[model samples]
Target: MMKPVTAQDLQTAGFVPERRRGPAVSVAQATVDAIQTMIRTGHLRPGESLPPQRNLARDLSVSRATLREALSILATIGEITAKPSGRGFVCADPGEKPATPSWRFAARYSLREVYQFRHVVESYAAQLAAIGHTDPELAELRECLQTFRRAALAGDISLYAQADFDFHHLIMRICRNKLLVDMHQTFASILLESQRLPTERRGNLMHAVQEHESILEAIAIRDPEGASYYMRKHISMAGSRAGLPLSELP
Candidate 1:
């Protein structure tokens, strides 16, 4: 029988408990990394139930909400599975591969179709934003990019998703085109989901962050063509990360 891993085991494995004051996403990511380290070092073995959430959270010096978010991310990536009784999570066998997430909107729109639409509409929005964005709008976009980078570095997919949405949505608004903004607003949920799909599939996000930086640099220089080109490239790469081949996109 696999022994249950206690919080003391984690502490002894160098999982230092610290009170951090910042975005909960970063804190949650620290929790995720600590748990992963414990598992990697054999303190938490496969099929072992984790310490109860209350005790674990207290030991980690993180809020319960932050701990829950970390656990949820671990579950999503197949590092752990929730117990049948909804009590706590258990470590997955290291040999077991994580399952790929299925597209939930396949009945209405194909993934290729969605990426194509994003490539067309969002690239144009970037072009327009490059020409029309004001100083304050550029500053806001820069801030959004920074947030996205931070979330990506911390491996906080949920926060990264929001930052990704805010970055593109800001571009739509900066374009000052009511039709474009309306279209983005109408399809906000779907767009956000599309953004999340790639992150869930790929472990590293710094490449996408670099792409965003290129796109933003173009926009900051008021180069509409460059902005449009970089946005197209970023969307293409994002699609490829989500299992859609660049050759398959139109």
Candidate 2:
């Protein structure tokens, strides 16, 4: 008879470990890795429902919030499907592709329109930020970039989404144009959703992270043209990743 998998088995596989001070992996990410490992190893079979959240969290030695976040990432990437009536999550078949999340504002705006608007506004914002940013603003931008990179590396989609928004919003603020900042803030949720959409598709996020680095380097060096150019490139590439063909982008 095969040995049954336990939390201890996950721990032995290095998916879960004892809590420590500032460990390399976030607790939530560690939990995500643990569950994915279970699915990959056939311990968590396709269509099998996961244990209740409270029980699973207890077994994993992670808080409910951390477990929820991990589960959210898994669902976003289509590793698991959430059942109705509070039934809990079920593992997906191996190699199944994640469904693209529906755009909530599709009735009001198409993705191509959003990307075109972003390309125009954000690229100009990047140029202005490069010219007008103070040292402290630049420092904050660098911090946001680091946060984005870390979140991408960890595969924490929620964190990555926030970091991506923060980086772009910070650049908008640094541009020091009241009208531009007001416009960005007015459509903030829509823009943040746009940032989140690309992450739902299973792929290496490092490419986007590298694009962010290019924008940051240009801003750090106060090269307005370079900043604008990179920002345009990044937004265009992001649009492509979100299923907007390059030809459709402005």
lDDT per residue for candidate 2 within 114-168, as digits (tens), equals: 9999999999999999999999998998899899989988999999999999999
Flag regions of model 2 displaced more than 4 Å: 1-99
Clashing pairs in 1: none
lDDT of 1 by residue, 1-250 (tens): 4345566766665554655444433576578778888888887789999888897787778789989867865765567877889788889887774355577888888888989999999999999999998999999999999999999999999999899999999999998899999999998888888888877662457767888999999999999999999999788767756666424544
lDDT of 2 at 232: 94
| Clashing residue pairs for model 2 | none
Please estimate how well model 1 matches the true structure, expressed as its whole-model Cα lDDT. 0.81
Let me know the TM-score candidate 1 reaches against the reference structure: 0.61
The segments of candidate 1 whose C-alpha lies over 4 angstroms from its true place after superposition are 1-99
Per-model TM-score on C-alpha atoms: 0.61, 0.61
lDDT of 1 at 40: 87
